[model samples]
Target: MAALLAAALAVTGCTAAEPGAAPRAEDARPTVISVTDGDVDLAILGEVYARVLTSGGYDVQLEIHSAQDPVSSADRLLAGEADFIVGCTGELLADFNPAGAEEIIDQWPELEEEGVGGFVVYDELIASLPSRLSATDPSSATSCDDAAEEQGLTQQVVPIFGATLFDREQREALTGITRLITTADLEDMEEAAEETGSVVEAVDEWVLDNEARSGGAFEDDREDVSYLYTP
Candidate 1:
């Protein structure tokens, strides 16, 4: 996995900025970023982030890794080539800290108990890897039922960091974006994306609605998510 990540990053090691088509105000110096992750679904989520932040007047450049695992994607962030990377809890746990991977098991106690959005357990995922490789509905196609008992383990998705140093303002931007998504909302958005014939548009609309919400699920009272990654 590490080698694959390295190879992928090496092949695509360059900043990809959004064109100046809808450029921000003249005084605006948007923070250019390359958002990356392994899954296409997560890539769409990155687009959601880009759409929301851009509308909020933040200069953001979005990039999709077009890969299947986030190992290299996170590596992109740590290397300063990308500003943001989002991955599932399981993916973050394994590759968030290349120097101290054991921290994945130590932190994120919720992974040991249950995953957010009813994500199946890791062991079960391993058990069904062969079939999962070809499954259409990736999330629900897991063979994590009675057949894979005693091997179930949940892996929730979350943003992680520690290896990178950020200035005060960058730090604020990084930590300020709270978890605005829920399981049902995610499923609905996924379906809507398919129905509307445009995943990017669906995600953009959802981000706008979430931003418009006042003190809703993703609001001012949101909490820090670093603990989900660090000890």
Candidate 2:
């Protein structure tokens, strides 16, 4: 995971501006922008806003929070800890009462309209010798090698797969797969990787259709997926 994360940061070249630089009082800086910690989905949106804000001469401070708990985030805002909080519009509507906050900027309509959330993949690899087998779910009780042994599939299949931002957890739940190959993974792959969206949608549809063949159940809770976006 660390390696993948490092690769992602390297690929995106995400960085903050230099510290100790005094903000120009007349520069129309954004002052601050609060965000949930390590949200790959939100990061995509945040990066877009960050670039625009910077170009507009705003000295943006990206605040990483533990979660998008509105009450907590609003407390920070009320305390003057943050000038703006970037999160799901649903969360902002619920947590930040428009009557209470001085202003609100809803970005959900823009995000959804633009299809901002990119595709993600969870790659599962074998970590043993002979390396003759690899499967999505290691805990499947039925091993890939066992199936291969039964069917005489000697060639090792890398099991390259992908999923959308929403279905990632569902795919993980079915296969007991822990590691995920996010947009960051493709960014890291450089010449070897293609756009994650195309791969994820195709693989996600394939997984849905081949559930019986894969011996995996589709028990993804839609509510959990919703929480990824909602505060």
Candidate 3:
């Protein structure tokens, strides 16, 4: 993993196109975004973002590793090897602020009874992020919410990014993607991937289905779908 990250950093900004060749469509792209990969669900989410961002005119690259561990992936994102990652609220809170995880989880049920809701954890996560990083508004969908109910954590899926890397338009586009996802949608995507034997193929099918269901809500053209988000 160390060697791979070093190699990625060594050539972070270098492009491979020949100088004399006529400008290709890729040449005009404004940003080349690097995204990290992890377990099956995270990998699916990464590809989903890649497709959405590509349609918005940015070049997206996925960094696949031999092993997919969430903590290591989060560390890589903090070190700036990649621009973005799909994370969860409770899980990331544990990763970034270990000592507080149990206390926060303990306090959650009472907060819910009093009507504070899941934002208790989400707000804590926002406060815990470093100055160099920012996270999108979390999706209602969580990779672990039901399965890990015993753990008393609300693992809301969220897109985390390097703050300095994206402009306002890019950030809003990503936030839009976050809002459109749901837990049921994620489960269906995973099932589709299992049947298709390819994450990309499954995500493509899911995108088409979503577009049709919402009257083309997930259109590729940025101008066609206007997403109004604050961050």
Which candidate wins on TM-score? 3
Measured against the true structure, the TM-scores of the candidates, in listed sequence, are 0.49, 0.29, 0.72
* Model 2, span 64-150: residue lDDT tens: 566545445445554555544433322232333432211212343343356541100011112221122112332211112332343
Candidate number that wins on lDDT, 1 or 3: 3
Per residue, candidate 3 scores C-alpha lDDT tens digits across 110-193 of: 877886646877888888889777877888888854324655777888888766554444455456567778888888988988
Residue pairs in clash, model 3: none
What is the number of backbone collisions in each predicted candidate, taken in the order shown? Answer: 5, 0, 0
> Could you tell me the lDDT of residue 127 within candidate 1?
36
Q: How much is the lDDT of residue 79 in candidate 3?
A: 68
- Candidate 3 overall lDDT versus native: 0.61
In angstroms, give how far residue 54 of model 3 lies from its true place. 1.6
Candidates in order have lDDT scores of 0.39, 0.31, 0.61
